[model samples]
Target chain A: MRKIYFLFASLLAGNFLFSQATPPPADDNSLSMANTQGLLRTQLTLTPSWMMKGTSGNDSTSISSARTNVYLHGTLEYYWTEHFSTRGDIYYFLNKNSAPGGLKKNHSLQVGCSYHFMKGMSLDPYVGVCGGISLVQISPMDFMKGDSTFLPNYQVPSHLDPVWAPRVGMNFYGQHVFHFFVEAQYLMGTYRPAIGPILSINEIRISAGLGFNFVILHKEATVRPAI
Target chain B: MPYSYYFSKLIDPNPMKKILVFAFLLVGISAFAQDRKPNKNVGGQFSLGVRSTISLFSDAGSSMGTGAGGQFRIRLYNFMNTEWFGDYLMSSIGTIGTRTDYHIGWSVMFYSPKQKPFKKYHPKPYFLTGHCFDYTRIAGNNPFYQDPNHSVASRWSSAVQAGLGFHIPFCERVDLSLSAQYMFHLGKDITAVTRTAVNGDEFLYIDKEEASINGHLLISFSLNIRCADLWHDHQKKGGARKAAPDPDGQNPKHIEQ
Candidate 1:
């Protein structure tokens, strides 16, 4: 896991360095990614996520053995400047896990901004943080006869907990109507229920797919008097 | 009814040919029919927008709620604007109850400094005040309130909100805005009660309380686009009209009047 993370970080760093040296391609009539002001990007795809480095569950299976969670991730981002953009993300709970005390529902909605590093190139890289709310619920543990279930059999109800995520990603803008992107986010949240033990809902989520972009407004051009 | 029309129709092989010709004629008529330009009048710039809202600090729920809605703006002046909007929000009260709210409202906004049309890069701050009619419903599925009599409650109320916000124009046609407002509703309130039994069982009951007022904070972020210029520019209504450009965006030949 550490090596994977290190490799991803190295790739991002290398892209950042390369983007600074690269310039927008000349003689291109298609939409220029370098002039990103007033561009809106919308994307929707299924993202597979896993619980990593969080509090343990009450079930027999350890946290590491829990089933992966799948979510429908939707993103809407708009560039306010060449190097700054605002983003809103929505993660809808899609699949349920069969593991004991697994996630019944895990959904979140967040809004934040990112700062683009290679603002003048088609390979756009950035880092950002977002804060939002997550609605999380864990499945009820099994009840066995002649078993002392009173201790861990607390009523684990759904909770709306505050969540913050720090993410890193890159967008490859190779066309006017669509682009490709891959992002990874480490979400931090704690589900403190009214009647159960505190469970950390921290997870690392990754998603990559095509997204569509719309140019809402074009920059004004200088006009010369007609002679 | 014309002789040429009948002659062409008689020679056409398929009726679809006349239909296609009519469609092309309609397109040409629609293309050259509009002579209106962007209005320079006060409150002439019209915009349509969508927003996401977070409802906070309400007695009905313990956690903040999220909702989405849309709005439209009509500029009243260089420094004033009006917004019409509607929203639907849902919130959960722990494990006991769920609450849903519907709001339809209108607000007037006044820019701190007179704003120029299509300005970019800087934040345009404004103050706003509005009134809205809201409907709220709260229901519980717990055992204590499972009976049809006491399981659900709903109410209708009118509210007024006032707040300040700012807009950042990313371009000439689009702007992103953030605002925070406190809305106080004037009517009955739907209250939720949680009771714990001796065996650590929790039950929730929902009921309509006496006529009273309640308030909550609403934070919203929205993106708006200038869709149309509704009114004619008073400064240019009788003056020389700007020369129309060709279809390819080139200036046409200027003909002497």
Candidate 2:
């Protein structure tokens, strides 16, 4: 019994000694001093967006007149430096209107750059301006000649309008590969159809979702940690 | 790189979404490109790629059309190039009418003198002019119309287009281009006009217009990859080595830790 106990203690001591000599594997989540150069981030989410008041560009002043639109939003961003990044976003419309003469489609693509506030922290806040195009179409509304008579559908054309937006967002990085982001964008545009009144495409959109971070070009870890 | 937990969650439920994500992921992974230094001496190169286009402001009503096509480029000089392309486009006319177009054309591209040669990250502006042979068909959505001849109309015509475009090269071998051109068709105009009946019903009528010239705008976006060098310019090969100075301003072999 005494010999067996001695053997077990010796084995335990040897294992502990060997473990200290070997360095632990590098953790991806472990904060370091390396610069965030050439990092690529991608995200996709379904966002429910509301068109703000006065979207019709008409005399109507009601704030809640327009309907809510849902879009499949996809984003691709690249960090050129620690504080500046280029981003492109695509919003695909995904709603079928009930009324014959309502918004048929509202799709947009925007590209811009953002200035990130936090340098090395897991949480980052940013502000940006983007310019792009919006493809919009409105179905022909029913023309009523009498109290009950309905006329045939009149076709209104689609317009690809130039749009610009200002955006503010926040990103919270997870322990390793994931990050959560939420952003608010105020877009402005006007759609000019061949026939009919000009329509305003101004709206406020908000989206929150998860994203993946990838480092395409790794930099040297030479800077000393602040702590 | 480790796969994010959120990615797996987002991709787990829908197989279609999985395919979409995978397709984008492949594009992201293949973003790596060879570093081609700016060659001042080389005048010729070759590239091939696919492009997508949006046709707008057509005379055949207000509906916009989306199209996909492919193009190949042959650079004869540092400032001159040529592109050959083919495109098939389809658009809806009003509510129940449709228009289909097939175009095959070639364009001569002249690089602007102000552009920096072989700079990958900068935008290089160019002017292009081209001519194309096209076939257009306009048809009514209704099959059992009263007039069979009025239901469908088609024409074969030729068009000329001129546009200003810019190329943004991401790497030595890959570039993205965007251009907007005004295409004028020289053929019989097939026009769709909306008319209202005495009963307050509105309908579309398809007929040939009195005018002979048709015009529209074409916007194109393309991604191209350099594949070959058709001609070997010895001076350009030598200039490349001299052009790329050391980023660190030190001999790479003699750098100290």
lDDT of 2 by residue, A1-227 (tens): 35545655886897698678534436654633344556777899988877765433224332223678888999998776667676789999888474766778789987666778888766789997666667888776554455653445756677666566789999876543667999999876655454434445678888899988776765343122333
Instruction: Write candidate 2's Cα lDDT for B1-257 as tens digits.
Output: 45777766654443556557766776665554545434443346788866666788568774676565778998876668898988766565654456677889989988854324344457878899999988887766432242556656789889999999988765566567889999999988887766655765444567876548788899987767677877644535523344433334444321100
**TM-score computed on alpha carbons, candidate 1:** 0.61
User: Chain B alone, TM-score of each model?
Assistant: 0.74, 0.70
Interface RMSD of each: 14.6, 13.2
Best by lDDT: 1
DockQ, in order, for the candidates? 0.05, 0.07
Candidate 1, which segments miss by more than 4 Å at Cα? A1-34, A37-46, A51-66, A71-95, A98-118, A126-168, A174-180, A185-204, A209-227, B1-42, B58-61, B113-119, B141-145, B235-257
How many collisions between residues are there in candidate 2?
A: 0
